[model samples]
Target: MASDGESPVRLAAETWESLFRAQVAVMRKLQAGPAFKKVALNEYDVLFTLSRCPSGWLRLNELNDHVLLSQSSLSRLVERLEKRGLVARMAAPEDGRGVLLKLTDAGAELQKDIGREHVRDISGLLGPALTAAEQKELRRLTEKLRNSVGARH
Candidate 1:
C-alpha cells in the first residue's frame, strides 16, 4: 500500500496501478510449484539472498533488511531452517553479541537444485509474454524500485 504523501513519492494513479497489477499478475504466474520442492517460496527467498552474499553468511539484522518478512518471523524461520540442518546459527565474528546466519553446504546445494527449476519456469512463463527488449526494460524498472527502497540486496 502507498503511504501518505510524507515520502518523496510521485506517480500518477494509472502508472501505479499498471505497475502493481502487472507485478501481481506475474507473481500469480510463478506461484505454482514442484519448482521449489526443497523449500517453500519464502524459505527460498532467504537462501537466494544468501547465495548472493560474499560469504554465504549475513547478520540477522542484515538479513532482515533484505528479506520481505518481519524480523520476528524471520527469526522463527531461521530456527526452523537450523533444525532441518539447512542453516547454521553462530556468533557473529565481527561482533560477539549478535547472531550470524549461514547457509549450510546442504542448503546451498538445495538452493542450486531448486533455483535451476525456478529459472526454467520463469523463462517458460515470461518468454512468450515479453519480448527481449521488454524483459530488459522490466529489469530496469525493478532495479529502479530496488534502488528507491534503500538499495538493500
Candidate 2:
C-alpha cells in the first residue's frame, strides 16, 4: 500500500505517467528553442555527455550506454559529429577494436554556449511552477528513483 492507502501499483503507474508527461512537455519546448538550431537535441546530448567526462576519452560503448539511442544510430551520429569537426575519434589504446570519443575544442565551446541557453530555458519553465525548496526535493527524489532503478552511471 502507498502512504495515502492507495494500491502501490496504481500509485507507481500514476506517478510514472506524470513524470513522463512533464518530461515530454518540457522537451518539446526546449527542442523548439533557438539553442537547438545549432545542433539537434541528440547531438547536443552527445556533446554534453562527453563534456562531463573527467577522463579525456570515453569509450564508444560506454557512451552508448548513457544515451537513449540505439548503437547503430549513435554510431551514425558520432560520424556526423566527426565530419563536422566537433568530435574526435581514436582507437582505444588497450583494445584495437574499441573506439574512443571526445569533444574537440569546437565541441566544448558549442556545448558551453548551448548549455548556458538551455539552463535559462529550463529555469524559465520550471521556476514559476516549483519553489526552490520544492525543486531541491524533486531533485532528491528523482536521484533516489534513478539509483533505485540500478543505473550504472
Ten contiguous residues with the weakest lDDT in model 2: 144-153
> Residue-wise lDDT of candidate 1 within 1-153, one digit each (tens)?
447654334445667789889878876666675776667888988888888889777899999988889989999998998899888889987789899888899988988899898998889978998999999998998889768876564
lDDT of 2 by residue, 5-109 (tens): 999999989999999999999999999999899999999999999999999689999999899999999999999999999999999999999999999999999
For every model shown, the clashing-pair count is 0, 0
- Residue 96 lDDT in model 1? 94
For candidate 1, the per-residue lDDT at 62 reads 92
Candidate 1 wrong stretches, greater than 4 Å: 1-11, 149-153
Candidate number achieving the greatest lDDT relative to the actual structure: 2
Scored against the true structure, residue 3 in model 1 reaches a CA lDDT of 70
Pick the TM-score winner. Answer: 2
What's the lDDT for candidate 2? 0.96
Return the TM-score for candidate 1, rounded to 2 decimals: 0.84
The lDDT of each candidate is 0.84, 0.96
The TM-scores, one per candidate, come to 0.84, 0.95
